[model samples]
Target chain A: MLILVTGGSGSGKSEYAENTAVRLAKEEDLPLYYIAAMKPCGEEGRRRVERHWRLRAGKGFETRERYVDLKGLALPKRGVVLLECLSNLTANEMFEPEGAGDRTVEGVLAGVRSLAEKTAHLVVVTNDIFSDGMTYDEVTTLYQERLGRINRELAGAFDQVTEVVCGIPIQLKVKGSSVI
Target chain B: MILVIGGAFQGKKEYVKKQFALAEEDFADGAVCGEEELYWARAVLHFHEYVRRCLETGESPEELTALTDRLIRENPDVILLCNELGSGVVPVDAFDRSWRETTGRLCCRLAGEAVRVCRVVCGIGTVIKG
Candidate 1:
């Protein structure tokens, strides 16, 4: 099953996604995996990553750092995988030296699709950065556009899509509800 | 207590006015209202701005918690409208980061005490809790 969990920063989406991964892993006895996409750039970035580590310290997830080219990452088949975010991944693909650059949409979609095929329960966490209503530079706007398309496409393909607000889950889609 | 939240320009004020039948004068503007005005206001708009001002005055997180506690104790029926500010990219400035996190935490606390919590999107309110 593919589940998309999205929310604003500090909206508790990370914690929610972690707990969900743990639950699914325990219930199905699957190996829990955490794919960290954010490249810890500065002090703040490192601190944020450490905070997440502390939150899931004893959750039994085997961590994998994949900054770009996610389609090549190797994982055990049928394991429970939690991708902490798509925002950072999208940026990495757009600007990183070895990232997809202009082909970010296809690159990211292919990576995610590959992960879904390899995992038993895939819980993907993404950001809700589009609603801020701030104008940005051309490159930043392109990044937003690309990420927005990625989110919409994945939401349609995934089994469930949830938007967490103030730490509460607002289900935007559910399994087999595509017809509705 | 009631909590209403959404992104900026999402018509939160209009929804509150229509839903609660509150007039313009019944609301306190958090952006410029005196701090004391919160204690007795019927409803507050831009509550996130109020939080920013509190932080700007060096109000510690603990003190802010106490102030909100007093708000609940003094006026349980007050309604709050806070923009969902944490959805954007993490700000580069230190103050901006803390401000965003602090507002989010405060809203979480308020949501817990609130008897009703509604999230607005495009001027429509969806009750997430009651």
Candidate 2:
């Protein structure tokens, strides 16, 4: 199953996703994978995220820290994969002056689709940018446009789509439910 | 206020500091590594802290809103710096993905508030606003 969690800033989307993933692992007895998308630049970034790991899983969760293409990590067959946020991943892909040429919308869609097919369960967290407001500048406008497109594609692929408001999870889509 | 948006390693912070003649004492700089000492270091560090705070508190929009309000209130020819993290391939992992999103939002928010905005590519600051 693929799940997408989205919300504005301070809405506790990350915490909600983390808690949900933890529950799935502890109660469901499934393997858990937590992938951090932030590039560990210096000592502080690394240490801060390390603290986050200790706090969340108590050193039990298998954590993979990286700043490159994420396809390298193989998803376990019978476990849960939680992608904390989509905004950062998309930004990383879209801002490369040169490498971005290799990444097309079609290619990203294909990858996400394949991942959904391969993973037993996948959860994705993203910021709801539209709710925040709009931008007038070109760079920002371009970023928002691209993010919207990516979000739409992910929403279509995921089996469950939820938006968090004030730390509350509001399910927008579910399997076999057309009310979304 | 001038908002500088560019990719990592681009001298957006340094350029802004030079333009404003802002000294180390005028602003506080926080980075992923620690508190930066130089103007450039502080600038990059500020962006890093912005991202970190958003991630840790899950309060990116609110923090940005407050910052924007503060900048407007201060109105001291502010120059805010940010990394344009959305110009590459989509990250497959959650953490990297979150950073990309947060950075993108930061740039957007800053650009919206900036009287002038520029995107530095190849050491060239191309005007994207004003």
lDDT of 1 by residue, A80-137 (tens): 9999789999999999999999999999999999999999999999998876768888
Residue A90, candidate 1: C-alpha displacement in angstroms: 1.2
- In TM-score terms, candidate 1 sits at 0.89
Please, what are the lDDT tens digits per residue for candidate 1 over residues B1-130? 9999998888999999999999999999999999789989999999989889989999977788898889888989999999999977667789888888878878878888899999998899999989
CAPRI tier for the interface of model 2: incorrect
Q: TM-score per model for chain B alone?
A: 0.97, 0.69
In candidate 1, which residue pairs get closer than 3 Å at backbone N, Cα or C atoms, i.e. clash? none
Q: Write the per-residue lDDT of candidate 2 for residues A1-180, one digit (tens) a residue.
A: 678888764345676788777776776778887766665556745864675666576634576643335554566556777775566666656665522433635444554565566666778887766632334467666767777887888888677888654334668898766543
Worst 10-residue lDDT window, candidate 1 chain A: A128-137
Candidate 1 CAPRI classification by DockQ: medium
Per-residue lDDT, model 2, residue B76, is 42
